[model samples]
Target: MTKNILFIMFDQLRFDYLSCAGHPHLHTPNIDRIAERGVRFTRAYVQSPVCGASRMSTYTGRYASTHGAQYNGFPLRVGEMTLGDHLRPLGMDCWLIGKTHMRVDAEGMERLGLSPDSVIGARQAECGFDVWCRDDGLWAEGPDGFYDENRSPYNEYLKSRGYPGENPWADFANAAVEGGDIASGWFMTNANKPANIAEEDSETPWLTGEAIKFIEQAKGPWCAHLSYIKPHWPYIVPAPYHDMFGPNHVPAAVRHDSERDNPHPVYAAFMNNRIGRAFSREEVRQKVIPAYMGLIKQCDDQMGRLFDFLERNGRMQDTMIVITSDHGDYLGDHWLGEKDLFHEPSVKVPLIIYEPSPDADATRGTTCDALVESIDLPATFIEVAGGKVPDHIVEGRSLLPFLHGKTPENWRDYAISEYDYSTSPMAAELDVAPRDARLFMVTDQRWKFIHAEGGFRPMLFDLVSDPNEFDDLGDSADHADIIALMYDRLGKWGRRMSQRVTVSDEQINAARTGGKQVGILIGVFEPDEVPPAASSKYRGPVPTKEKD
Candidate 1:
């Protein structure tokens, strides 16, 4: 049977927030339902904690170092092969229904003479997906202009429905009405108040409706990426949902006073940053956490709607449904508000994949603790669409074998995450060079090591001893052996074949011995030293040098 893929991604959703993941307050029955029918990966991490870099990794099936789109506004280069590039060859149509957080490499495209109007160029510009509807959903307007320069369809929709403002995305959808004054949701104080818009017009529900419309009209054998941009920032929800949770329901922040005592310079810089300082306050957490929970609850309800639509249309039987997030929100965890650190709240995300084929029956509803990366999704989609994963380009291994209740040989022992902070204020505050303002996290089952570029020492967390990551062992002399071992692993990963994308392993192996057939043999001392078949052409064509 021809397979279809429904890839659903939520923005800033934590791995532990769902009811299935043991969250005590938030009940996500729809998301839990997906987990019940599929395998929930407990240890899945994104290649980067931030949205754009993580999404780029997910789309290209490569790490941030490989793809070179290492931050929010960084562009995925024009020639990088993405999920659509891989699956489209096998007669699978790849499409985007909502946000990709993908910035087009206009400079690279211009150098290559690729027009965004052309089919291939359009795909390349859109991170390889054919655009059904594209919205990055950050419509915040500053003094200069809107955060996203792209035209806002969401704003237009809000206007058409009589939302009274030039930017209803900020006015009605993201702001609260306080005594006839518009209280911007950008501030955490307004987070407890209901947004001025109706619930149906909120970003999550609107995006869900867009997804259902796309699936309803789409042809079979397709991969539709439904990426939502809510539960991210502007942490305010519409009425009813806004009051769903309060300060009482908010979990205690996962942090300690000891974490701030003589912290690593890099970590300290992040902690002292504006966002971190704000979230470090108890009042901010009390105001923001409840609204954040409400946004997720709204998303779960939309999931129920979308799933019910799929069931009614019989799309569930043929579609491989995947539910995951770009990355988790820090949400005051480790005294951080955003996802720019290597902590579990910032890097680890929820990953649930339901393969509709009976081959996946053996592993249904199981939980896998294997160290999985976000890059694995594209590899999984390529395999599901009946295409061989091009290992030279796609760095991630297919998860199909795991879904079929088999462990693939030589499975990865660790997961990697990268953060490029050159463009961030933290870099400037620390006086770091642009090239040196970077952090790499390599985490296994026992330890999580963070290697910061420049002259700073590495940060170490003994996950076995302190799973909550309260203690730092980077400065401890007793753990020198373990730190050295982790450094060796990081060096080995740095030497990976990230740029050898033009040739496959098979091609390299075939070319190794086939060179002699074209009379390019090297290191041959005598005719007898080489194979007879290889020396045949040289034997017949002996040319004597003319006296000169």
Candidate 2:
């Protein structure tokens, strides 16, 4: 049994949603079991909030700035080595089973045995993932559209199957709860969801079936990546799961038409930074929280299936398993949904890695509060498989030290997370939500500073006292020195890691049509927002969307 790696991930899982962490309703047995068998890290973070950049960091072991894979459609700079490229020579078969959202334009094809122009951007080609399948695309679709190839994945997967106009609350309440999240005939959240999605018309069960086959047949010392998209959106889970978490413990979400206090716009302004819109607290709790948690339970069940397969095959002890997410869900926290803003629920995530061995002391079945970034995954897995990470290719350190019972106190004194809200202001797509130009921020254990120029005053939060970030301490004379120090830190770090966009001649021509500057002007920091706490080197954003 050579060291095989099973890297399993979901799209938008939240850190606080795990049952092991005390959400009595979550019931995530498999993941909890893995935690019991390995290391459950309480403070894992991702470099960026979106899929593309986050994947870049996970595969390359560097910040988006350092690796230059900052956004979707943005290719990694030529010759930038990824951990996969580093491991192939070591005789480890690095196989990707689903969704590697890397850009597979012409160049990406050569890496995956496809021609970019001829092939639609498939999941496998983009990120050098060997084997892949994209989970119901984009997480939203219309009624009877859950599997539709053309409609949004979210809409289709979430479209209700019960009688129309029925109270969603009552409909879910009628579902049965047996065996405490025990697998019935089905194992997902939305078993009752209508089939006939154009792409997955037959049944999603087939997808899982293929996965079982993949696990059974994979080669030795293999590194496999499985990307699950259930809990992402279109928040429709199968029947029982929809009602799984008794209403009492469901996490609260923002409500529609409820926002009254968010006066400031997109931390600054730019394209894609749609005008901020307001939603009420109750709306999120009623419509949003239920759907989101339903999806979580659904994915949780699927994860259980994956683990059950491992256990049945007796591979649980021989494999090094990791469970995490690209990023987290906003779930109406800070009056937002999706990952973009700089809120804790949006940036902070859960990271659990299990290497089933007894002598592997200090980490097995233990919890570590060390601050870690998603960028560290690639390097961590590379090491677990008994390979050395190349010096030039890693911006993240391996977690082997922590696993070996030697986590240094200052291993990571501070963690960094970056965001790029670079969309055109006059551009067609704008979030009808709060929009700001661009803002930068940095957070240590206690304070958070956000800098927005203009009437958008900088804000400082004493997280120790105000974890919700409800108050601004920027104007206080007491924290001026700390503010100045953070600004300098952001400057120096940004200078070292930020990447500039390099568009080809064709892309430049396309941009010229709008008479807008198509070239990406990657900068060290977003135009300073009045600063309280801030990340040093973040870039880009726009104005347009207005919060109601």
Candidate 3:
């Protein structure tokens, strides 16, 4: 039986970047070890391609549309339940060790009269987690001021370690010390230089130490969401990891000249995005990819340290480990920069789950090619805790069967992803209304379809024929039937009963049974068509006319 859960998430990690997943140069043996011990999902995708919304979906086991945190920095409306909410009922405590990228639902809290400092209020404010440490990790200060509202604990730690600056997170932690000058990590050119901070003091290692400390002191059943903020942006690594890779180690961009020729309107808009434009240059990629690889390598090394700690403490036998990412960076794929589009590189992520039980031993070092989603983690955790998965609450099916080495029948055929660009500058440039600035993606094994709101034509790619997703078959009349079928699937998904939280399932079921006893026939056609008990009330209806 699994006594604990260690849910780990890496920020902006690509699906094919790991050694086990066949990256030519960037090897991640520590992560691959988890895959070796359990099952690796090859086709797992996130609910969204952006950080905030994607993490919200993963935490809540629901789509971005259902959670209503559809974009970065968007609040996950109060009263929305998360993994913490689901597991707490089962006597499992959920604690945060690192970043959640959660923006509190302040407006909802205000309306409900919840104090931000109170215990329950704080849990609600911090996405239902009891905070061991909460840091969004981006403590950047510009001329306009700090990019975030909350104080970064990582920055405070750097300050305590004797790094001097108003923003040491940038000056030392992310910057390269070059002959008394601080080279900002945000510049791609500075990626080759090592960060000023010591390797042990780097973000990944510090967070790993914090998590180990938490586990050592923690009692009873608990889950530590060890979220790492690295390989995301400000691409710079500390010490040995900084010197690990070079320009030759970076792979060629997955873009082509055909993508630039008469692209779809929304696609073209993304291709022309500022980040996309910058990454399109080969020089920028060569300089930055090495740093990104270094950060990942450091993360993997920290994982080795973390695993060693668990083994030393004898906790490895009881903990169920899940390794995944919130979303993938475009990294110049498909003529894009960040993760916003529905291409495989942006939305698909590496998912590895290791259930520490004899039952899962049969599937060790195996790969599962089922279509999995980031939302499935909540249900998986709940099940691992030996609790009943509340079907009405969690939108995803549990992966317990898979973990037990059983292939489930009648699984979902398609994986879905959504993106809301209303708050993006692209909406302003394209003159799209916030309400209409949305896109939905539906994909099976062979075909991928993208449906944009506001009268925009759908984008379709036959993934079998065009694996790179460079060609747009939306304009081709030959694929019209396929496009219509995909739209139908999207429509079916949209029509699901979402945000229906007013009544419990038991109450709804009770109404069905209780109504029949009171001579009420739901969906009754003719008077005689009702049940015999219900017919009693209708047969005596003539008495009402006599009274009148």
Which candidate should be chosen as best, given lDDT against the real structure? 1
Candidates 2 and 3 compared: the better one by lDDT is 3
TM-score of each: 0.96, 0.72, 0.93
lDDT at 171, model 2: 28
Higher-TM-score candidate of 2 and 3 = 3
lDDT of 1 by residue, 329-377 (tens): 8888899898889999989999999888889888889999999999998
What lDDT tens digits, residue by residue, belong to model 3 across residues 458-512?
9999988999998899888999999989989999999987767666688789987
Compose the digit string of candidate 2's lDDT tens values, residues 1-548: 36878888778888878887677666778678888877888778888877777888888777876765666656764345565566676777677665556663456456555553332233234454555344433422246753223323223222343232222211222122344432221222433332112212212233454567787887777787776664665454555545555457656553322222442455323212322232223433455456567667656666677788888998887888888988887765555656765667777788888876665655677888877878788877777777776534576778767776677555756677665555434222334322343446667777666665335555677878877665556667888897787777677767762333244345666867754543334562544642322332233465569889
Among all candidates shown, the one with the greatest TM-score: 1
So what's the TM-score on candidate 2?
Answer: 0.72
**Candidates 1 and 2, the one with greater lDDT:** 1
Once fitted onto the true fold, the runs of candidate 3 whose alpha carbons sit more than 4 angstroms away are: 502-507, 514-548
Cα RMSDs, all models: 2.6, 16.0, 3.9
